[model samples]
Target: MMNRRYVPDLPEQNALSEANFLRLEKLLGGLKNSHYDFQWFGRNNEPVQVHAEIIERFKFTSTVNLIKQNSALPKPMDRVQLTIRMYHDARMAEVVTWDSGRQLSGVYPYPNDRMYQIDEKAQANVFLGEWLAHLLRHGVAEREWTPS
Candidate 1:
């Protein structure tokens, strides 16, 4: 079995940073249908391949790190880390985050928007897009990462 611990102030950590979000805005502002492949943890204990359209006009903010804890799965899984608003909606200041090590923890609001419920399909699209951008900019080479 896995251990799950709740941490305080998860929302603040996941919110997007200002500079990064501006970069996203610029990219999305001029985006064309470019195909990009990126990998991230899925709800299951495995890597997931995400494919998305690179919109070049949408803006994104930045993210903050939250708690680091283990997953609820057995051995061989990575710890779940939380981030505060990694992205903000242009129309509204909605904060979103990417929760590590947990499956189905897609882009979500951090109690900022009182009535705005996250649509899973939409969240997946946004997550895939934002995550792809992040990986392309910061992902370590596959050859460099070795299992500990």
Candidate 2:
């Protein structure tokens, strides 16, 4: 019996990307505004900040960083960072590179280089969707977001 390796569903991945793009676009106020401070409480009830910023605009490159200012080296949660690319024409968004500075491939052969999961790209996009959802749920923008 041959082991069934995972194959990516391009349509599903694209759908996720498309949904994420709309969520992010709304979060960024139609990509007109930049900066969302996602405030959440730590175990001690201290406020923590998850900062989202539009670092670049041409084709919309953005970075979401969770580092705390004036603090020591961040913990893994605090160190989560993602470099995202937004394709307005395609109405899609993707994680171009992750905190480890590695680009996730669309599909990977089982036991392939770096031992990445076969559906890494789709997983990353799903992760991005969750992040955007969390931000939309708890984030506070510099200005109120309203449909324009």
Candidate 3:
């Protein structure tokens, strides 16, 4: 288990560095069934919380309200919700944008919304492991994640 805390200011150069992504990938790869809760400061200093689960696949649900930081407050009109899905087989990992509040257009199989694939060998920006690592490193967590 690794620390899941929000880092307000991280180095721009290492925003999503390969090393960081590798660390994240290793952490999640060892898990079976688990729930991870994270809290972090988003852009504009808004508090954001991400609830992630690891079952057959990895799912992340994030919520943020630009108008209010308190969770008890009424749902804000400017609330933003994002969902990400990562599915892995024996050969590669595929990441998909399950849902997003920012997109104003069509349904799930959108033309621009294509599944990103990452193979075993680390390539340029196509590494899903690295991407997940970056998210875990920057995304705030309520506590360290422990696999069940």
Each prediction's TM-score versus the true structure: 0.25, 0.75, 0.37
Q: Across residues 66-117, which tens digit of lDDT does each residue of candidate 2 receive? A: 2232133365655667777788788888887777477777788877867777
Q: Each candidate's lDDT (Cα)?
A: 0.38, 0.68, 0.39
For every candidate in turn, the CA RMSD to the true structure comes to 13.3, 4.6, 13.8
lDDT of 1 at 102: 31
- Write candidate 1's Cα lDDT for 1-148 as tens digits: 9954434343442343334455434433322333323354545655543332322223564333322223444644343333333345542222234344333333345443433334432343344446536655653322211112
Q: Encode model 3's per-residue lDDT on 4-118: one tens digit a residue.
A: 5433222431343334334434544444426666565666666666555554443432221111133533566333333323223212232332233342222222224453222
- Candidate 1, 146: how far from true, in Å? 33
10 residues in a row with least lDDT, candidate 3? 61-70
Which candidate do you rate higher for TM-score, 1 or 3? 3
Question: 2 or 3, which is superior by lDDT?
Answer: 2
- Runs in model 3 lying further than 4 Å from the true structure: 1-24, 27-29, 57-91, 100-134, 144-148
Candidate 3: how many backbone clashes? 2
Clashes of each: 28, 0, 2
